[model samples]
Target: MRNLQGRLELCSINTATLGHREPLNQTIERIARAGFGGIAPWRREVEGGDVPRLARQIKALGLSVTGYCRSTYLPAATSAEFSANVEANRAALRDAAVLGAQCFVLVVGGLVPGSRDLEGARSQVVDGISMLLETARECGVPLALEPLHPMYAAKRAVVNTIAQALSICETVDPDRSGFIGIAVDVYHCWWDPELTASIATTGQANRILAYHVCDWLHETNDMLLDRGMMGDGVIDLPAVRSCVERAGYNGLVEVEIFSAQNWWQREPDEVLAICAERLQTVC
Candidate 1:
């Protein structure tokens, strides 16, 4: 079965690519019609207007949830800011449970402005995740710590490497617990010298919770939102896929793009069509 392309359960779409145009219900229908196995939606989409209603819509469309977009942004300068972030995560976690999402992706917070203490931010992240892991486990939702690229180390996430994410998980959960894991996205880790080894280690520990796919533009125009389409960029996606598969991660390969200028301007159906084509050819 090595030549069988593994399984067709590999295709998923992140709803953000279509956020500029489609409603959540319409997007789900479109994605489902495109033969995708699952979709990962952002909290903004989930809370756009209604949540329970949207959850029902997702189930009716017969689409699986790869994972929730995010829940953690724990590094804050003040107690009030920290508490607010915690509350947001609690709400997001509940939403994940309601939608039967596979995991609640966590972008552990980065350095606050004017603060250079990387270690401090990471400690806060660990604390926040530790505090929420219990509630996550109780709700039957997994928390997938997403290690963002170093480019975002100062503003989005301090956990910038797979090794760092796994270390935090190991420390917070210690016993290689089931609910806390990592979300590996190609765009974030393609340049990592330790990616392959980290994937192997994560797999052996059974901490590979979610897998996201996207191409990283060589001439990255925008640091935050300019993600390229699969084959349009330079990432060796299939090679990454090989690593993930070898590591025993057979979960959906969710496609997450934040192309503010490219994809977000296309028709939702057109985006889905392209995604379908790319899923076969590029991803």
Candidate 2:
């Protein structure tokens, strides 16, 4: 395991941690100034123009682009909608390549609207990902499938476990070509009894594309927004980190917190500082 003690270079910041209060350019500057080794920006923030220029800016600041924010939702009610969603994801992959991001994250969609067909939604997600794999390979941008917590299985993501994500990867890239893999987020996965084994399997397969860290509040107010800072919640951060390291993951550890009421209310600089401090001590 890489010792992060006093080594902020292993740390990366996902811009959402800043609550979208600053512009993308300013966010990049602040993250770089805050001494983060990398930054992950959302698609919404990078959709405007001159993406290559933006990439250059990030590089000029001596920071890496850890990963692109996300791909479009894969499951839809209609064939046309699903095709469009796939195309949108293709575009995001292209953008990720231009930005020199390590990989493009995918938050696979859940049950189609007005439908309880969970199996059908999972099928659509598989097809969507299979369709995008060639483009991702062509662009030299890997795809990271992020399995959200089961709590979001109904609306956000149907791929609710690391095992499930790996299943999809196996189906799509049986050769383990590394074109598609899984993004392990502790906030969504800490409660799983199989986390350690699952991470070990992912490591053996060499499919751990990205690693995200944040705390799960014990008394959560909002399922979507209330995330606690590291050391302020019940998750065993060092244990989780140990799992990833034992699994042979050596990538940047991204700090992604979506706290609408707490961290978001504070200044971005302060949040960055605390993240750095907590990462060194607790994480």
Residue 202 in candidate 1 has what lDDT? Answer: 91
Q: lDDT by residue for model 2 over 168-199, one digit each (tens)?
A: 99999999988899999999999999999999
lDDT of model 2, residue 93: 92
Q: What TM value does model 2 have?
A: 0.99
CA lDDT for candidate 1: 0.85
Worst 10 residues of 2 by lDDT: 1-10
* TM-score per model over all chains: 0.95, 0.99
lDDT of 1 by residue, 43-77 (tens): 87777477878788888878899998877579999
How many clashes (backbone N, Cα, C below 3 Å) per candidate?
0, 0
Q: Pick the candidate with the highest TM-score.
A: 2
